[model samples]
Target: MQFLLDSADRQRLSLDARPDGALTLVFDEATGEQASVAPRTLLWYKLACTLPAKLPPAIVRDYATKTFKPAQAYGALLNTLGPCR
Candidate 1:
């Protein structure tokens, strides 16, 4: 999936999901910077973008109910981490 990271210049960031269950983040062009993002963070960011309020309620419900397995698993993992400080 590709996301626009910068709106002014239309800089894009891509998330490539490999067949072996790995994810790679790619930039549209060389930016001469180093960056790292956790998988869960990326997942939430994607959800935030795709499930915006401007979308129809039915679409949002379908995405949250049918396509939210990753978020659900992340939630379960967070539960095992105990309460936040």
Candidate 2:
């Protein structure tokens, strides 16, 4: 998976996910402002991006049939982004 985020600050960030389980995030090319997160961390990043959609309790219960919404899982998901790297 890949995506481009154009910030209001006029910055273009290129994000790429590879089949080999690696995610590359590039901020700039001239100054080499870039970083790459491990495959697992990348997965968490993807989940975090969609967290808002699962924030509603009704939606969570309807789809997952779980009483609790996953919004509370945000912290644990975010924590996975670190240490695992």
Candidate 3:
């Protein structure tokens, strides 16, 4: 999973798999950190940007109102800012 932030630098997020089969967020090649998150949380974040007015029908039916890890089917969000000068 990946996200191209709408910022001046066009920051990017890259989700990678860990040895234990859990999804992890990777930025700037750093590792050894926990990156677990709820599937709905990630979906809501995306919908917030694409459809702030209302929830998309598909998303509502599929992701909304769910409370499970579903780790195999979901990944966490990783945010990073541009390097400082």
Candidate 4:
């Protein structure tokens, strides 16, 4: 349920942060093991960071909450320096 972590349903989109503090939403519906809609991928590359803020007005902007991949969810997963996933 953690950010960027594999999900059972795979519906839980996992987003992470980039080097410049931006975020990269990586959620490939197709595991390459089967077919799926938007199978090619539906990535949101380099989204702006929004940490210390709760519940982003836009659902796509929210940070890791309970189990959701927050916009700035890679704050810790990055060795405290890597991308915010």
- In order, candidate lDDTs are 0.43, 0.53, 0.39, 0.39
Tens-digit lDDT string for candidate 1 (1-85): 2223333457566544433434445654576332333444654455334432343456445656554654444444333322322
TM-score of 3: 0.27
Q: Please name the candidate that would achieve the greatest TM-score relative to the true structure.
A: 2
- Runs of candidate 3 exceeding 4 Å displacement: 1-9, 18-21, 28-34, 43-85
The TM-score obtained by model 1 is: 0.30
Worst 10 residues of 4 by lDDT: 36-45
- Local error of candidate 4 at 72, Å? 9.1
Off by over 4 Å in 2: 39-47, 50-85
Residue pairs with clashing backbones, model 4: 17-84, 63-70, 64-70, 73-85, 74-84, 74-85, 78-82
lDDT tens string, model 2, 1-85?
4546565589887765565555567788688787876545654455445433324566445644255434444333344343332
Question: What RMSD value applies to candidate 1?
Answer: 8.2
Better of 1 and 2 by TM-score: 2
- For model 4, residues 7-34, the per-residue Cα lDDT tens digits are 4565555544344444444466365232
RMSD, every candidate, angstroms: 8.2, 9.2, 11.4, 10.5
- Model 4 superposed RMSD (Cα): 10.5
Which is better, 1 or 2, measured by lDDT?
A: 2
